[model samples]
Target chain A: AQTVTQSQPEMSVQEAETVTLSCTYDTSENNYYLFWYKQPPSRQMILVIRQEAYKQQNATENRFSVNFQKAAKSFSLKISDSQLGDTAMYFCAFNMNRDDKIIFGKGTRLHILP
Target chain B: NAGVTQTPKFRILKIGQSMTLQCTQDMNHNYMYWYRQDPGMGLKLIYYSVGAGITDKGEVPNGYNVSRSTTEDFPLRLELAAPSQTSVYFCASRPRQGDYGYTFGSGTRLTVV
Candidate 1:
């Protein structure tokens, strides 16, 4: 079984600063996908970024980027120029190449201090 | 598009009671999923369907039942609700592509007293 782990339970970053949420996973498959999803107070799950295991380049979406170290099985999300609206519970997810089932980490509660 | 929609946004059930959490999607996605999110805990996959007729278990599949009769609907049934089952349930759907992401429903907040 594959499991995603987010070590940080809570994280805070001041406006205009940067913060990184760490994630690690255990899987035997070589072809898989990694994702970061955000859940705000609205309780809506939104995709932040994603990285394919076969790709060497990290995935970046505006202020969000992933530091995907395939060899280390580490996928971390970095939020730059944080805003108040960025405060949310962030989750790391995993999906296999041939399956649609997604496994999620516990989550990291992010607070953007203004 | 309506994306994925879940009914009974909030519900309260007592022990030994039963209820069905309705989930429907308009995107015509071939893959659908059900997950439960406990307070401060990450989402746990309960069940998932590859298409209209194929269903499979996920990370946590106990105490739950699901059926996928069509591509747009996948409802989860709880026969004997328990306090341990109290959590926010979310439904999500995704395209068949490996690079595509999932579209999640607003979620149903269930309280099992």
Candidate 2:
């Protein structure tokens, strides 16, 4: 079974500061996809970024990016120039290539202080 | 696109009561799913359907039931609601074949008293 572990349960940083949320997963398969999702106080789930296991270059979406270390089984999200809107519960998810099931980590509560 | 819609944005049910959480999508997606998020926790899969008339249990389907009568609608039913079932439920959908993540609903918060 694949399991995702998010080491940081909660974090706080001043607005305009950069923050990174760490995530690790256990999987035997080589071909898979990693994802970072954001859930604000509204409780709406939004996909922040996605990274393919075979791709060496990490995925970047505006201010959000992922450091996908496939060999290390680590996928972390970095928010550059973080803003108040970046405050949310971020989740790290995994899905095997072409598989319907996507496993998720507990999530890291990130707060951007002003 | 109204991607996915879950009804009763919030609800309160008493013990042993039964109710269904309605979910529907406008994207014509072939796969639909139900997941529950306990307070300050990750989402857990409750049930999923590949298409109309094809439904399967997910990780935590113990107190839940689901049916997919049409490609657009997948409703999750809770029998004899319990405090443990008091969580926010989200419905999501995706195309049958692709790594294109999931389109999720705003979520329905259910409180079982």
lDDT of all predictions, in order shown?
Answer: 0.93, 0.92
Worst 10 residues of 2 chain A by lDDT: A94-103
Record all residue pairs in model 1 with backbone atoms less than 3 Å apart, i.e. clashing: A106-B42
Worst 10 residues of 2 chain B by lDDT: B94-103
Which parts of model 1 have CA positions greater than 4 angstroms off? none
lDDT of 2 at B75: 93
lDDT of 2 by residue, B24-108 (tens): 9999999999999999989999999889999988999999999999999999999999999999999999887346788899999
lDDT of 1 by residue, B24-97 (tens): 99988999999999988888889999999999998789999999999999999998999999999999999884
Residue A75 C-alpha lDDT in model 1: 99
Q: What value does the lDDT take at residue B9 in candidate 2?
A: 100
Clashing pairs in 2: none
In model 2, how large is the Cα lDDT of residue B4? 92
DockQ, all candidates in order: 0.67, 0.67
